[model samples]
Structure formats: structure tokens, C-alpha cells
Target: MTTLLAASQTAALLPYPALAREIAALLADALVRVPARLVQALPGGASLFVMPAFDARLAIAKLITFTPANAGSGRPAIQGDVLVFDVASGARRLQLDGPTVTARRTAAVSLLAAQRLAPGNAGPLLVVGAGAQGRAHLEAFAQGLGIREVRIASRSAASASALAAHARTLGLQASVADDPERQLADCPLAVTCTPAAGVVLRGRLRDDAFVAAVGAFTPAMVELAPQLCRDVAARGTIVVDTPDAQHEAGDLLQAGLDVARLPDLRAVVLGPARPSPGPVLFKSCGWAGWDLAAARCAVDQLEQS
Candidate 1:
């Protein structure tokens, strides 16, 4: 029987650090992302993505969606289930919370980008957003990048302070920034983890900064300013989880940023290391394969336990 798991229970079961290592290896495989289909509704949104690789080493064919009303009502923006199947026989092996998988994979993949895309000796990090994804990115990046300093920003100063305080306990030089724009002046690596509809770092950035925009996924949601997109497209290379999704991202399109063509995460990696280039940008639009890989890692650990 497939063991049932709850959020609290599953949280305890999933090991973020170990899963991240596995995810890094999976991401480096140079496989093209499988296609995803969207089904939109007035009150909610859903998508079905099929992530397949040779032999189905890790595959997740599933539906994911979010309901803002439900989330505002103390529910979850994303609420779905995943069915892990054996590629050889198509045998169903495990079932887990899709939201949990999404959170872990999304954070892990972004951290992978940070660790792989950032300069070998990167400096202070600026993270926008103080929620779960923000915290996950902070922790995962710290573990992955050996980051020395971290500054967190949120709509609410108190919330940002709380998150910063927690991060400080992890031995990071952490603090809260009331205005993230001001903090960006000295930051070398930045991660946008919020779901803001407008831009966050429009006029605030150094010439040589690596920014990873993971907030905006849908056609409406956006986190970076129009100018930021233009800057990346013109000056530095912009790496994304998937090129097609990036083309549909509101901020990039609104900015009128034109890249003769966009490159995926695979393009940034040259034998598991960041390619030599100018400033860089990596946009993460959560993908199903990452969730599948993360769940597989969690299941492996659970079985060992």
C-alpha cells in the first residue's frame, strides 16, 4: 500500500540538502524539458506537464493548480497530488503532496542555478520575499553556495525581520531590508522569490549582478522591472528553466526585451560549472520534472528510514 502523508509528516520526511544534491545531478543531464499544457479557469488555474527522460529514470506526469481564494481563506494556493510510477512497467509506486514536491524542487532548482550560475567567489545575496519559498531559497543557497551574507525583503518589515533573524541563527550574516532596491547596490547575486505582479528591482542594480527571477510564472505575474529585462537581454545572458515559458512571462514581454533566442538552464552549464560570461539572469518557472526528482529523493530517504 502507498503510505499516506500529511504536510507536517512529509515535511519531516523530506531532506532538503540531500535532495538538492540529487537535483543538481539531474539538472545537469542536458535533457530538454518535456512539454506542458495549461487549462485556465476564472477562479483557478491548472496545468498538466509530462516530464520524461530516457528509461523514465525520473518522470512526473501530473496536474497542478492554484486557487487564490482558497489560499486567502487559509487554504493552499497549490493543492494537488502526485502519482509516481515505475517507467518500466508503468507501475504506480508512491503518492505524495504535489505542493510539497513543488516547493522543494522549485527552491532546489533555483539554488542549483545560483550555485552553478554565480561567479566562483560570489558575494552578499539579496532575496526578495520572506515566505516559505524565500526561506527555502535562503537555506538551500546557503548550503549550496557557502554564502556569507543574506538580506531578505518582504512587503511587511516585521515578517522580513523575523525571517532574517531565523537565518542569522544559521550563521549567515542576515538582515532585513525595508527597501530592497537600496540593498541591491552592493549585492552580486539576487533571487526574486515573491509573487508580485509588478517589478521589484527596476532601477536598483550594479553593472555586474546575477539575478534569478523565480516569482513570475503565469502571463500576468511579474517580479522584475521592464528595464531589468532589457538590461539582461542586452548585456548579460538570461538563463531560464524553460524558454517557451519565459517568452510568455509578462515582465519580459512587457519590457519589449528581444533576444534573437532565449536559452534554457542547460545552456548555462559547461561540465557542471557556470560558463564564463558577463552578468547573468536565470528565470525559474516551476517545472514538473523537478518536483518528480525531489519526490523521488524524498521517497528514497523515507525507504531507508
Candidate 2:
């Protein structure tokens, strides 16, 4: 028999600080030995990716797709499923919702990084792109990262205003930023979740601020401008979740930065994070191992309950 876990059930599994810690620990473990994620491009600018992760007792595979155009259709830009398997028998154990896992785990990853990288004074968090990922980050931050105030901005006024209202219901002081560029300079902590084909994030970030750019996975799409990347690099280390970020992070690539040389979150999360001279920037190209780890955690919780 097979069990199907939906998006809501997945949300119920990991709450707040627990979700952030779980993903951080998983990445920390992966640093000891990381697996390569395979990415393939499909026709019409879509992409399919396979992420495989395992430990002594369990193994998991996740198949996810990236459709940049889906944002306008009321569907997610990314979606897929996680397949859990028995390590010794190689039998598939269960199936989990892909979009939920992606959104939840992605937010957790960014929140975890923010805790380590963002200064204590970081306030009124700025979120660019009022989409699924943007809303997820708002929830994750309000619950665990100590971010109480938030500013939501997007190309769509309805989407931005809606997310802001939702954030307020969560007890977060939230507002819609009609002028994203002007607000960018005041935020010490920010997250960019837009699926922009060109530079959507412009203007100088606050000194000693931190920004997590989760979109722009393809080389052609960009969310952060070159000056922002250079600014972060000049002040602090630019962190990536995986080494594959060099090839996958369009934000960093377009900035003319040496993506291959960027240090990963493995080192940042596993150990104590020290203060940086300037700002910190975390660029994520979504890892399959994170899905595997998140699924494993959810399964364990399900069996326990």
C-alpha cells in the first residue's frame, strides 16, 4: 500500500523552528558527503531535475520541474513529488507533495540562513515577489526567524496586497511596498522570490544587510542586480546551499561573480556564524537532498503519530 501526502498535511508535519533546524542539520550532514543533482532542460523553457539523497537506513528521490510561465496561470512555477524508498530493499515507500515540499523546505532553508547571516538589528524584512515562495518565507520568518515586520512587493498589486494582509493575520506587521527600489535601501533582511527574466532587483542594499535570492535558477533569469552581488561580496561571503549553484544560480552568474568560489551553507549552518564586515547574501538553487531530508522527517513523524 502507498500513502499520499498532500500540501496541507506536509505543512502540518514541520512547524516553525523545527523545520528550519531540520533542513539546516540535513545540509550540515550532506557536507560530509554530497550527492550530485541532475538537471535537464525541456522544450519551451521548462526544466526537470532529479535529486537523490540517502543515509544508512533510508534513501529518497525527488523529481521536480521548473515552469517560469506558470506564475500567471494561478499554478506554481515549480512542482514535483518526493519518492521515499527502503534503503536495503530498494522498494518505494511513499509519495509526498512536491510543491508543498518545495515551498516549505525552500522557506526553511532561507530562514535558517537568515538566522545565521542577518544581524540582530535586522527588522521590517523585505520580500520581493508576492508568490508562493514569498508567502512561505513570510510564514517561516514570523514563526521562527524573529522577523515581525514585513514589506511585500510584486508586479501584481493584488498579489502583493493579499500576501501582506495574510501576513498581518499571522500577527506580523505587514505592508505592500509600492516602490520596491526605494524600500530596498532600508531593509537589513530581504528575500527575492521573483521569476524574473531580467534584473528585477536593483538599488543598493543596506550596509551589513542580508538578502536571500531564491529565484532565478536558470542562467537567463535574474532577480538580483550585479551591484547587489558585488556589494555583498565586498562586505561578507556569498553563501549557496549547494556547489551546483555555480552552474544553476543565474543571479550570481549574471553579476559576473565567481560562482565556483562561493562557500556553501554547509559550513555556515554546521558551525557558529561569525559577524561579517559588511552584508551577507545567500543564493539558493533548490537542492533535491533537502526534499529527501524533509520527506524523511515527515515520514518519521507520521509513523510516530
Candidate 3:
């Protein structure tokens, strides 16, 4: 029988530290394969995404729907499941909750990027967007990077307050920022998790600031202002999660930056260390390889438990 894991159960299996390790390992391993995902448009600004990936031990496919309009409707904006299979036997192994996997793995990717690219890991993190992605980034950075303070910002005051309160419960100093852009200079570490309906983050960052821009994953959606992206490209380093980001990273594209010239996470991970003088921008456009890493991590955790 194929074991099915609920959202909570799946999350419990993929802890940030372990998940980050798995993602880092996969980034360094060339054997993992991910094909282009299939995306279909649905009515009322919704989309269905079919992503598949495989490695020596496991194969997985994630089917999920994204509805940007569901932001505050008490309904999840993303929903679906990930089907995991054993590579050798070609038998079904496990079914994982898709949104949970997406959230955790995405944050883990950011965490791994920060570990390698961020000038400093210890932080007073400025997280813009107090939704699920924001919460996941908060937990991942707090646990994985030892961040002791956080500032929450969102279009919704109530949502920002809720995420701030959640942060306080984690034993961190938490505050809601009325202007996240102004907070950028003081907070050396930040993550933008907004929906990218329009630009939500802009303004100057500290010279050594590290930002994981994860909100905008399409050509039309963008969170970072064009000027901010250009500044990073000119003065600092801009790294993408995958080569697919060349087409999907609206933030960089809008800035008129040649994304093809930028280094990807894998190249950074398997690097011959280079020096960077200014802020680091890590742009993440979701990739199936991340979900495959998540599946491997989950299966490993299940066996140990």
C-alpha cells in the first residue's frame, strides 16, 4: 500500500536542517534530473502545474493548483499532492502533501542559498509578506540560521501582526514593520515572500545584505523593484535557483538584466569560491528538483522514525 502523508505529517518529516542538507546534496549531485514542468491556465486566474523529477533512488511528480485570488479567503492558494515512487522497483512508495512539500522545500532552498551566499547568517530577518511562504521562511531561517529577531511586513496589517506573534512564540524578538523598504538597510538578511501582484519591496539595502527573492516566479509577477534588481546586479551578486529562472524571474527581467549571465545555485554550491563586494540576491523560481529532494528527505525520515 502506498503511504499517504497529510500536510502536517509531511511537514513533520521534513525539518529545515535535514531538508537543507538534502537540497544541498542534490545541488552538488549531477545525476538528479528534472524536466520542464507543464503549466495549464484555468479560469479566473488560476493555474495547474505538473512537475516531475527523478534520481537514482526515487522518482516523484507533484500536481498542484495555484490561485492567486485566494490570498485572504481562508482557502489555501496552493493545493495538491506529490506522488513518490521507488526507482528500482517502479513501485509507488509514498504520497506527500504537495503544498507542504512546496513550502518546506522552497524555504530550504533559500536557507541553503543563504548558507553559501549570505555574508552573515546571524540575523534580524526582514520578511515581507506574512502568508504561508513568509511563515515557512521565518521558521527555516530561525531554526537553520539561528536568527534571533524578525520584522514582518505585509499589505494586510492583521496578517503581519499574526506572523509577528507567531515569531514571538518561537522565542524570537518580533515586530511588524509599517515600511519594509525602509527596514532593508538595517536588516542584513531578508526574504521577500509576497505574491508579486506588483512591486512590494523597493529601496536601498545595506552593503552586505542578503535577500532571497522567492515571491515572483513568472514573467508577469514581480516583487522587487527594477532599480533594486539593477543595483544588485551592478554592485553585488545575483544568483538564481535554477536555469529556468532566466525565463521566470520577473524581478531580474524587469530590471533589464541579462539573467543568462548570472550564476545559478548549483554553480555556487559547487564553486571555486569567489569574492563578492555587495549585497547578494538569490532569486528562486521553483524547480522540480527541490520536490525530488524533499521526497528523498521525507522517505529517509520515515524510515528512521
Candidate 4:
């Protein structure tokens, strides 16, 4: 039987520090082994992305579905599954939930960037958007990074309030504050995970604020303003998930950033990132390698339990 792990089951196991560290290591390895992420366009203007990574015996692949039409049809904007396999036999070992894997791994990647860029101590966190990505980021930054307060920003007041309520359940001080600039007043870290067609945050942030955005995957959408992008590029450095960020990250593309000018996770993970006098911008276009790593971790946990 092919074991199927639902989103809740896989997600419940993600809070473990050991698992998180393991996935982070895998992600680092994946970045080196797989330099580019692959995407396949499906009919109906949808996309299928394949991200895979492995060592000698085991391999995992994340197959993601992006259907823009599912924006509010009860279906998710992103959907798919993670497949764990035995390399020698080419046999499927287990099936893990896609959204859960993507959510956890994406947040883990954000934390990795923040760990390298943000200050060592905890600071107020600002999470833009109130969707799944937003909620996941709230938990990750608060529980994983020890941030005590989180400001939820969204276009919908009810959504922000709901996220704030969820945050409180996690024992973090949280509140809804729509203004990104206002949220950044006392915060040193912000993560934006929306699908806005235009800019979500602009203007100058604190001197060393850590900004990580996972939204704006298409050329038509953007979350980070050109000013912020240019400022980060000029002042500090812009680190991305893959070398091909310019293709998917509309934020970088619209900012007039040259793909060669951006620093990728490969170099950043190997050692200390480049010097930066200003805030560090870590923009991720959702690499499949991350999902593969996260699935491996989830499978290990499931087998042990």
C-alpha cells in the first residue's frame, strides 16, 4: 500500500527542531546538487513544477500544481504531492502532502535566510498576508526563531484578525496592523507571502531589517517595490532560493535586477553571506528541492513514530 500522509499529519511533525535542522541540511545540499528548478506549463494556464534531490539510495520529488483559476474556488492556488522513492528499485516509498511540505519547507528556507541575515536575538516580526503562507510564517518565526510579537498585515481586516488570533493560540503576542511601514517601526524582520499583482511593501525599512518574500512568482505579479529591491541590492545583498530567480521572481525582474547580480543560496549556505550595511532581502520562488528535502524529513519522522 502506498501510505498517504495528509497535510495535518505531515504538518504536525514539522515543529521538531531535529527535523527542521535535517531539512535545512538537505536544502543546502540540494542547492549545490540541483542548480535549477524545472517548470512545466499545463493546459488552462496552469503550471506543474518538479523539484527533486537525493544522495545514493533514497530520492524524493515534489510535484506542485499551480492553477490560477483556483484562486477562490475552494481549491488552492497551489496544490500537489511529494513522492518518496527508492532509487535502486524505482519504487514509491510514501506519499506526503504537498501544501504541508511546501509550507513547512518554504518557512524553513525563510528561517535559514533570517538566521544568516537577521540578528541573533529575537525581535518583533511582521508577516504580510493572511493566507496559508502567512500563517505558516507566523508559526515558524515565532516558535522556531523565538520571536515574541508578530504583526499580521493584510488587505482584509478580518483575515488579519483571524491570523492574530491564531498566533495568540501559539502563545505569541500578535495583532493586526495593515500598514507595512507601521509594522516595521519596531520590527527588524518581515516576511511577505502574498500573490499581489503589484507591490505590497515599499519605502525604506530599518537599517538592518531582514526581509524575506515568497510571493510574486510570475512576471505579472510583484510584492517588493522597486525601491526596496534596488536599495537592498545597492546597500546589502539580495539572496535568492535558486540561480534562476530572475525568471520567476517578478520582484527581481521588475526591479531591473540582473540575474548575475543576485547572490544565490548555494554561496550563502556554504559560509558567511556577503557584507551588507542595510537590510538583507531573501526572495524565494518556491524551489522543488525544498519540498523534496522536507518530504524526506517527514517520512523519517513518520517511520520512526
- Estimate TM-scores for all models: 0.85, 0.93, 0.98, 0.91
Residue 135 alpha-carbon offset, candidate 3, angstroms = 0.2
Candidate 1 regions with alpha-carbon error over 4 angstroms: 8-14, 27-33, 42-59, 70-73, 120-122, 270-273, 303-305
Candidates ranked, most accurate by lDDT first: 3, 2, 4, 1
Clashes of 2: 1
Candidate lDDT scores, in order, read: 0.70, 0.80, 0.93, 0.78
Q: How accurate is candidate 3 locally (lDDT)?
A: 0.93
Please state the error at residue 23 of candidate 3 in Å.
0.5
| 1-305 per-residue lDDT for model 1 (tens digits) | 56666766656655666776767666656652555645556433434343432224545555556665553355666777666666667666666776776676777787777766775436688989876678877877787778889989898687689889989999999988888899878888888888665678886456567787878877688898887788777766677776666546666667775532666775654354555466778778766666666666867787798
Which portions of model 3 miss their true places by more than 4 Å? none
- Please report, as a residue range, the 10-residue window in candidate 4 with the lowest summed lDDT: 27-36
Superposition TM-score, candidate 3 onto the true structure: 0.98
lDDT of 2 by residue, 1-305 (tens): 56777778778876657777777767656332337877898999788878887876567778889887786898777788888877778777778888888888889888888888776544788999898899998888888777789998899999999999999898888989987788877788888888766677778777668888998776777888888788778867789987888988988888899988888887787667565667788899887767766876787777879
Cα-lDDT of candidate 2? 0.80
What is the number of backbone collisions in each predicted candidate, taken in the order shown?
0, 1, 0, 0
Question: Largest TM-score belongs to which candidate?
Answer: 3
Q: What is candidate 2's TM-score against the reference?
A: 0.93
